[model samples]
Target: LGFALTCQYLAARCAFGYGTDLRAAVFRHIQTLSQTELDKLGSSTLINRITNDVTASQSGVNMFIRLASRAPFLVVGAIVMALLIDWQLSLIFLIIAPIVGFLLYFVMHRTIPMYGANQKRLDRIARRTGENLDGVRVIRAFARQKQEDERFAEDCAELERSMLAAGRISAVLNPLTFLILNLGIVAVLWFGGGHVDTGRLSQGDLTAFANYMTQILLAMVQLANLIQILTKAQASSLRIAEVLETKSSMQDGTETPDTASEEAICFEHVTFGYPGAGDPALEDISFTLQKGQTLGLIGGTGSGKSTLAALITRSYDPTEGNVRVFGKDVRSYKGTALHRCIGTVPQKAVLFTGTIAENLRWADEHADEQTIREALETAQAAEFVDAMQYGLETHLVQGGRNLSGGQKQRLTIARALAGKPAMLILDDSMSALDYATDAALRKALAERQGMTTVVISQRATSLMHADLILVLEDGRCVGQGTHSELLETCEVYREIYEASAK
Candidate 1:
């Protein structure tokens, strides 16, 4: 009880720290996540780690300290106390102890790998379910609900099968253990009868020996239980180790930037690939966007548009080239320094469960209400936010569920602008809004002083206003010029413009 209480107290404190640190780490990880990685694991498994996996690990640790630690002490002490009663009967314990050890050894070895597979299968199920739920609206819209349901059910079945396999192994061990223990007790009685008949052993001594035999068997049971706990823990440890040991594919070079760029963003023959991918996502990409200039990017899906944004912010360093910002290579700026300078609104607008003000503060914690209001106005969000009951303090549910798609998109843009970053990136963020809203937002951004902007979009109206536009296809820069120049000179650019106009 004392140990249990102590563990409960420590668990409460550890839980708070675990929650805070893991939340921050996961958030940072999401920011740096590439599309390839996201596609590989999906959101649900990530969510489970942030919730279920961590919970399991903490529970396991708590059990290890509370139950596993004390049980062994009790078991060992009981065994030693038993040995002092009768040495001849203690010889019976020595025989069965090794047998129990061998049994536990077999169980542990078999169950450890099974438990590991079970947990991974659980992660897969979580990922599938999460993907289905998040995209339920779209699934229904496309009449693919049945298809998604089937996929989720398949994952669930696989998880169940894996878990049952482990359970079956664990379930068999106990009965086998009881049988072995009973046999040992019968042998003790058979041997002790002759001693008692010849008056070689006292009646009390035989009774004590019988009781001690029970203790020895009980100790074996404890050892078996400890092995089971360790099996589960071993599996969990490996999963956590996978995440902790993963080296970020992007790392800074020892070569310092001897010189800096005057431009806010510069890509020098930049090349990058998804980790372990065969081909580069962005190859031989080069660009220079000075402070206060708007550089627009246009391309088909998979044209490395967002990859370029990631490179600019140093989410991933170019595999074969340099990405320079603010007269220094971005690698030179670590942690807050690099992040503070660049603000990004991704293609999918993301929001947390907080007030509008709180979400904006994510970009700039020191930003005042006035700064937030200005950003909202710039993104065309202030009018709607003002009409709400709480305005800046208006509560936002997770993923902005309370708001329209366009509202969420505008809120993301507002978040980017709130930081007043030297460089702002909108990665197809305006797709949800009407052309009117998109145009107004762009115009407002244009009016902002000394803010360099990058826009990745498919819309002609969006990129038409840019100082320069780069057209991309198949990971190569096929066109680079003003809107008119691209339309006249680049066939791909003209085809895109004509298609959008249609």
Candidate 2:
């Protein structure tokens, strides 16, 4: 009944919504992670913490409650029974006590650290495996499957070696304990025989004395097992605590800014680095976009375009300087207020397995069907969606595999637009669309939307009509102005324009 009630409480408290909220908290904690910390281990190790480490901790807690609650009563009961039988024979148990205690102590001290190290290694293996799985299509296409297989095999082997070593060491503990215990029993027999021969101990007394010796050792063995379990649990608890206790470097500010501004977005002398990076990904960058203005950003890959977007979204904080939205530091307007105002379509369009309407609803769950359809129309996705058998209700496979690349991009755009955000960021979202489709989408946005927009693109055609164009080279802004001005004054912009034109 106690076990059932305990399970019921856990089940009720850890139901789907509760578990999801907890996992989200844990997930967010992992996101603002430092490269140094993540690099020190692997994804597999983190998974172990979320899975095996947690299990070990719960098992240890259960073991502790069971053994600690019962051991004292059993020990006291056995001691009293032994004294009633023959007090002298009970003295034989003292000879073997220290040996068992020392063995348990030895396992306790050494095994805890080993378990910790082993969990770390398991995380490494998980990280490697997760990376390979996510990139399996690329691996196969590039004929690198064999290489990945070798890498995965090596990780698996390392995990096996660590587990085997720990298991082998722990294996010796139980048997050695019993061996010393049986030796103590042998000594009792040898000593008890003399007592029996001298007529000092009765037959029932001798029989009961033997039973008492067995019970005491069994009780000690249980205690030893409990110690071993507790040690492992302690190690695991420390690891989980480390993650749960870590403060996100990008904590939201306590104060919120209610004052809106004409400047929709601003980056003021921003400098940022990944955790522990020697050089900043972005340095002393500054820019501003007025309400309803379209700002075009062009740069080479890794020139910090995505990092800029992440900073704008407040996914991370600048090491020095500030990113402001609505004329207030973004840190101040966090949680729902800031995010609801910005719509971002990442470089890769990710779609969950759901109906088209459901996916769009993520942008605004309260949005009606008319709002969903209008957003789709603005994205130039209404035509395709209407052609489908289920229209907005059509089920999508994982990652929107049922749709073509352009369709997925349009769907993502529609989803972003459904929120009717104050600011819109399209991070190379048009890459998968054809030139004609891209032009159509741009035209539709120009005619329909009044929000501030930032478009990151490699193609010159995508930004030819922007109010302002910022050209980046090697992480520095090389040119900033209208397209016509850039073409006339900026050599790099001219070169990029000519190359794309050709």
Cα lDDT listed for each candidate: 0.79, 0.80
Query: Which residue pairs clash in candidate 1?
Result: 260-327, 261-327
Report the Cα lDDT for residue 443, model 1.
91
lDDT score for residue 201 of model 2: 85
Q: Stretches of candidate 1 above 4 Å error?
A: 1-43, 68-70, 73-75, 252-261
**RMSD (Å) of each candidate, 1 decimal:** 3.3, 3.5
lDDT of 2 at 338: 73
Cα-lDDT of candidate 2: 0.80
lDDT of 1: 0.79
Misplaced by over 4 Å in model 2 are 1-45, 66-68, 224-232, 255-260
At residue 291, what lDDT does model 2 achieve?
A: 74
